[model samples]
Target chain A: MKQFLHSGFVRLAIVVVMAYVIVSLCGLREHVSILSGVDESGTMHLVFGLIYILSYAASLVLAPALFLAAIIETTLSKVNVLSRKGQEGRRLGCSELRERQRLRAPEHAP
Target chain B: MKSRLCISAIALILAIAIWLPLLHLFFRPDIGDLGLEKGVSRIADQLAAHHLQIWTNPDLRNRELAQMRQLNPEWDFMSRTFLVMALASIALRDESRIPQCLETIDLVIENTLLIEQEDGFQDFLLGYGYADNWKVQPPKSIFVDGEISLMIGARRMVADRADYQHLMAERIGNMVAQMTLSPVLSAESYPDECWVFCNTIALAAIRLGDVLDHSNHSEFLREWVETAKLHLVEPQSGLLISAYAVDGTPLPNGPGPEGTSIWMACHMLQVVDGAFAQDQYQRAKAQLGRSLLGFGYSREWPRAFAGVMDIDSGPIVPFVEASASASGLALLGAAGFSDKKYLRQLMTSLNIAGFPTRKNGTLCYQASNPVGDAVLLYALVQGPLWEKAK
Candidate 1:
């Protein structure tokens, strides 16, 4: 579980979900003047804009980043495991072949 | 560590690449549903339904008007005019709903005239009009007279009311006498200040008056149009100057196509000169219309014209130059011309940005005041009245 959580893919999916919730809770879409860099009260509605912008950034930007990171990391880890297993199998095969050879040589020499 | 960092960097780039282009999809509305099919569009029906509720519910109507009155009392009067016209258009389109729409229309017209009678014409005049003797000695405002006349004309077009006809004729008589006497052939909406918007509406009222009363004003309407074409146009834009003095001199703002004035004027202009009106619509659309990220809006002035922010323009958004006021009126222009693409885009923008609030089956936009809502409602239901008048 710790290893799973440590995976970049899992962490990014969590960030995307959290951001979606935050944006929904904040009611950022209702403050559309933030798109124009203004608020309903006619001043700069910066905080709302920032929250929405960040949420968007996370969804499109950070979340995607995390997903890609996760995919790459998972792919790399799987490759590493497969390659290690292959090496171990080869080493075991070599040892088994030498043992068989020694047993055969003893029979022939006697 | 370096390999991990490199992976993270690539992921970040990939995420940005994936998300930026897809963002608009999140905001994309079902545009096909809003297309003009059957007699009206879906958004138009929703807007009309919302307005029907307001006209029936006194508390809601008053609550909406009170906010507008606080900002500018003129909106209180204008909102009534737009609502009455909207109801007329809806009544004509949907015969089954006529009885209910007429009830609200009558209530609006009756109450509006009553306010004008009790409060006097000055009651509707804005602060600038009331300032230090801009009005003639009799203190009549063409703005008040023009809008009220059009309201009465619209009401009669739906179903004639004898009392409204009498009142309309009386107002028309006064306007004709005034227009005949003025050297520039224009009437003042304020003290010595004439607006193209008011003049076009007043002219439309006269045209409707001729239709309902079997009177002739074709010659007069023609003469006024010629005069406007010759003198009222801004040299650069070829659009009529928004406001002018009694002697045909343009206001300081020059011949700019103001968002608030252009669409509504083009609407009334259809009654005066259909060809000229279409010309103005195309020009105004070219000058003011803007689209961004599939959302459409309008600007207060054309790119060639520079102006400051005012109540009519609302706050101008920089870079894109989106004006809330212009965008609202753009609906009228788009609907009038049946520019389905622009209309669809504007409506989508409205859904995304207009801050619509729906409750108990009634709807309103929180971002807009009563007048803005009325203008939008007018856009949705305005077709029938113009067709009937024509």
Candidate 2:
């Protein structure tokens, strides 16, 4: 049932997360040039040159939420009743096949 | 079923740990932007008040100094600088606190000048600095002179009193003339030695020049930094040399993002040139600022530069050169840039490891060098002076 979480929404969520991180980090380069000045107090302030901090910040807020939603979907899908039944069936069938193999094996009583 | 339950439990814990800090990041804090304030930020306020106790109470100050002296004398000098810078900010933030902040500043200015006069300025340096003569016949140390002048200069800039302005003009004139006489745009601080600290001081002096109407000095300050970029600063790290001779010669050192130092350098350069200041801060931030399990840690140097640890870096622990100087100074840089997230992480780290011991209603971080605390104070009280100057 967890496999059901591998759906379109989950994929889209992951892609959004990656894209958000990429663009947010890329935007900081411009800030590098702006902050390199001697301040009035004569002290230097070093920011990572993330002039568009709000944008990286926006991504920082959104990307993780999307990823969390994907994880929840994956978890919820793993808990379905039919999926549980299907797993039970597979476990029983495998057990029975093993028992039959044990019974059918022609071995001298060593 | 049991295995799945255990796995899920572990995953849930990890996820919560990861998301909690990021979650805090979402909520825009309604508080002030971390300038000097009264009771608004208990954290920054407490930090300043603790340093205040040193000047206000001689007994407490002596006890603290006695303990720190066993470590390094540089720390002792740094404590004065940091506290002076912090009080200057506090004065700006709380007008009511001016009388108190000014008292501390006055005492510090007096003591600093007294120390310089008594020790001949070289007393604060490492023994090696005194060894062998500097190549230039008339030895000089712009580093000592520059910072001392700036400290006094900043105090006066915030709340002008007649005493400080006169001293600043004298220091500013001397620094400007020294730059002009040297053809390479480099002044000999110690014989022929040039240092980033001194150069930054000159920049600060020039900035004060602009504020005080020292018009003729601008061109000299501008040209010196340009020539300096060619002679002292490395093209690779974009960080300046740890030390250099007069003629741009590398003295066994290439480049170091030396711990704590890089952050201080960034903060200092912020005074020298805005464009250069911006570049230094961003470079240091990218190279050092890191996050692990949602916690931030800053390194001493970037990958491009390799260096051995020393008194300045202050003990790089394994796997990462977490130079106390660089990381502590990074706090100033991060705060200066207004990178709230990094600042938050750094503050959190300070709270966790900096060993805050609240004594007599004042807050100070234990395990931090005096210089480290000074840098922190400068970070806290930085904005108003800059804004006021403009």
Candidate 3:
């Protein structure tokens, strides 16, 4: 659903999973020499190396960042919701009390 | 969908930004962590054992050697030299291993000389080595002669072999006579190409020959050093030029560090002249050495010089100018001079970047071949040989 796709946590999870898949599929970690754009075969493995490096960076760096961002976003949104509920509750309570007081004022009036 | 994707992208970028700076923290190597000690390091023992295993077992040795020979036969020959030197140093360190080391030394020497005799000196050189006819009457490559002599001299330094003693004398005699005859006191390792690396190894071999035979070539070494100081130095970088013509003309790629070349030059120079060797190491350190996020490496050329990438330089990483060959060999220079800081940094880099693989009690870098591993082994155990020679 659009709702699920819009969820920040779900999006981050997708990215992390995608990166993990690509990283595993490419066998990037085993080819660390790709960082220098050269492999043991003495040819430029730059494209593969770039993919490996990027996937690695994403896995280590971006995944954690997305998790942190989702945590902060969820926490802040929850706090906002809770505070709004508390204010509404207080206002409703005050209005209800006023109504009772008004109704009782007539009873207790001279 | 677009908004969600944008959010995800932003989060990813921020995460990557945080991770990139701290990534090296996971790889930062302490000197202790690298197994570096006062004399021979633990990694040295492991690497030496791996090489010993290869040499002792023909199946493993042939497979490894065939891989290198497929690329360059010169690497196969050089691997023999480096392995012999490493084993000699290890023997000097541990008396119990002397017999085993000597056996391997004789085996390597026998095989190398056999190859040279059957295939000729051109067998030990790149095809370009014989690209043109030699200016000198009879073509003898200092590259083959020099490394072979050092191999022989190192063998004698550990324990005298009368056969190798004669071979060492003969090789040094030829080198000395060749230098004496040349106008600039330089001899060719190829047709007209002379490498400072081969010449330095020849000088070190001559010095070791003196230690063994009690015949001093002190004056000749002194004159050669003087000539090199005046002509062989790259004025801009103050490091010795890598290659030159027989007439002492600096080659087009002359002034570059050429990673594999400089480290060996620095190592061999230690025996030829300690003070000068230290000076070369320092200049090279200032120019080519780099440490980023605790990982140390060496550049193929100083920042001031624009150089080409060759087989010797290997592939150079763009921003840092880190050469695979140079960075690996930087260990030799760092260890040779007792430069603990750089040594530790370089070791950390090797672990982080060099793709170390150990299986069944033997170790080798997956990213490097047999020749690279042999050179690394020599760098690790190199000190003992120099100490004994001194």
Write one digit per residue (lDDT tens) for candidate 1, span B55-146: 67889777766656666787788878888887787778778878887888888878878888897787777777666565455667888998
Q: Where is the poorest 10-residue window by lDDT in model 2 chain B?
A: B24-33
Task: Report every candidate's CA lDDT.
Answer: 0.77, 0.63, 0.79
Tens digit of per-residue lDDT, candidate 2, span B1-390? 675555445544554556656654433323353543433266667777777766778897776665554455556766776677777777777788888888889898898789788977666655555756765444556766676777786787667777777787787777766666555555555556665655665676567657755455556657766876776666676776655666656545424445465566666666566787788777777777875544456876677777766655656758755655666777788877777777766666555445455666776654564456667767766767656543
Point to the candidate with the largest lDDT.
Answer: 3
- Which portions of model 3 miss their true places by more than 4 Å? A1-110, B1-18, B30-40, B253-255
Worst 10 residues of 3 chain A by lDDT: A34-43
Error of 3 at B323 (Å): 0.7
Listed per model, the TM-scores of chain A against the true chain A are 0.65, 0.37, 0.65
Better of 1 and 3 by DockQ: 3
Per-model DockQ: 0.18, 0.04, 0.20
* Lowest lDDT 10-residue stretch of candidate 1 chain B: B32-41
Badly placed stretches (over 4 Å) of model 1 are A1-110, B1-35, B253-255
Return the TM-score for each candidate structure. Answer: 0.80, 0.71, 0.82
lDDT of 3 at A8: 68
C-alpha positional error of residue B76 in candidate 1 after TM-score superposition, expressed in Å? 1.9
Report model 3's TM-score to 2 decimal places.
Answer: 0.82
